[model samples]
Target: MATAEKDGKIYCRFSRPKSLASMKVEEEDDPSGPTEITIDLSSGKVIFIAVGKTYNGGNDLAEHVEAPVLSSGKVDFSQFKVARGTTMTLLTQLHGVAMVLAWMLFVSFATVEGRYFREGFGSKMVCGLKLWFQMHRVVTMIAGILTAAGFILIFVKVKGLSKNAQAHTYIGIIVMAATCGQIFLGLIRPDATAGWRPKFNWAHRLLGKATHILAAADLILAFRLPMVSPEMRHFGTTVVAVWISVQVVWEVTFEVNKYLQSKSPKVDSIPGKEETKIEEKVIWKDPNGRLQLILCILFVLTIVSCSVATLCAILIF
Candidate 1:
């Protein structure tokens, strides 16, 4: 078996074996995909076959009916029998694709922006970070699947990791709790958005921050990083610092740019119908909309700041 570290921590075990029909028959099909892509431990050939459904066929690569949701482009027979060690590579693919899917679903569901654009990247991809909000529900559901799978695999299969298990377990629990809370918020968000938007937004943002923190913590705790005579806990701290710094820079840059853009003279000259204002006795007419925007910004900041804090707290602990 040939093993290669593809990314920083995620390693891939490769082999080249012919069709292993017996292994396929014996093993339970992986629920990740329609077909079960199995590896022959003796060699490393991945037979892109699938086991049948309850009332259907068996594990024959050729006889599989379901098409791969994530295609490997044109088939490359030469690059086969690859097994990834960590969940990073697979989760990256799943999360990336799922984000794209979530964007599409958002556009389909309630995209006033999607309708106006005819050319260029559709509102799905090109739209700003608010796109994240619109697609939150679908994206959460997809990310939920990947996160759950990863938790199960890591908890069950991680054999030798002992020092950081407690921290890792804590982070996993936070993410799971956050994910459930986020999903719940989204389900009631229709009514919630109308009345309790502020609270809902806070809960969602807090969970978002929790997810980022857990992810950063997990990255550091990987078995094979900073093997430079460093303690395992240092790795966790380093990941937290790096993740927070990067996120802060990305978010701040985005906001500064957006603020500058919105302030530009050209933006205000759009041919809209009327000005949003009212000369009442003392009350502002559009308080609700203003409140909504304020809550949105508040949540955004909450998530960013909390993510930064989660890592800092772990380090201090």
Candidate 2:
């Protein structure tokens, strides 16, 4: 097949075989009406039939034309198979996977582990740096790098940004920008004693959460991108579901712990004052809280369900 343009209209010509005496070409300009072409090849001369339509030299060609049926003898057209080695498709898939995994690692491992350190549940110091802060910083840095790389890859693959880009593309840009802003805010985060500390902290938390949610949505949208296979779509959906489940479990656990800790009585005393009397705080001990137990069971069930469903989909589909 060859395509050419003349007189502001596009034309595509398919080479005919010698054994094919006559053939009919049909083009669907609309769902209800199709344009047809009849070629008489009985004169033993090579004839080229041009379909008067504007071809954008993309996958739209496949949508416009129907499969050709030879009137005479069978002709093998396997040689015209579309090549699948294009850089755009490969780079898009790479960008999608890399960005998805990077964000997943940030949410599932880095953020959760950092919280553990922050809450004094783990060792505070690691190799001279504060464990929580360092883990958060490193993971965020890696995630930012991956996001930037994927963002650039998309632009490179598309040659430049298009005004008519998909919603996912726009959302990705916003997510990357928000991530960069979040990183900057984190670097200049004030100490607990600072007046602006609470405000900054809330802003940082909210922005980070929003960015993660948007990133998850962007990953789901990637399944709808051109050239993505059904199996890959299912895989992407599974990853999104797993990430969401982990996030819900972590958030619920954190909230429950916070609520329990708030119920404990606090100590009131000055550390270095001579006239001050220190009053000890009452600690609440509940190793097996009902809410915690229920959340854990739910979390476990979610993980199991996601795993089984994903495996079944892979096998069945």
Cα-based lDDT for every prediction: 0.43, 0.60
lDDT of 1 by residue, 93-133 (tens): 34323322222222112221122111112244535433534
lDDT for each residue of candidate 2 in 107-223, tens digit (9 for 90 to 100): 544555554336442456878767777777788888788888988888898888776578888898899899789879977988889999989978987888788888878866765
TM accuracy, model 2: 0.59
Kindly report which residue stretches of model 1 are placed more than 4 angstroms away from their true locations once superposed.
1-134, 158-164, 223-244, 262-317
Worst 10 residues of 2 by lDDT: 64-73
82 in model 1: Cα distance from truth in Å?
17
Each candidate: RMSD to true structure? 17.5, 11.8
Count residue pairs with overlapping backbones in model 1: 3
Clashes of 2: 0
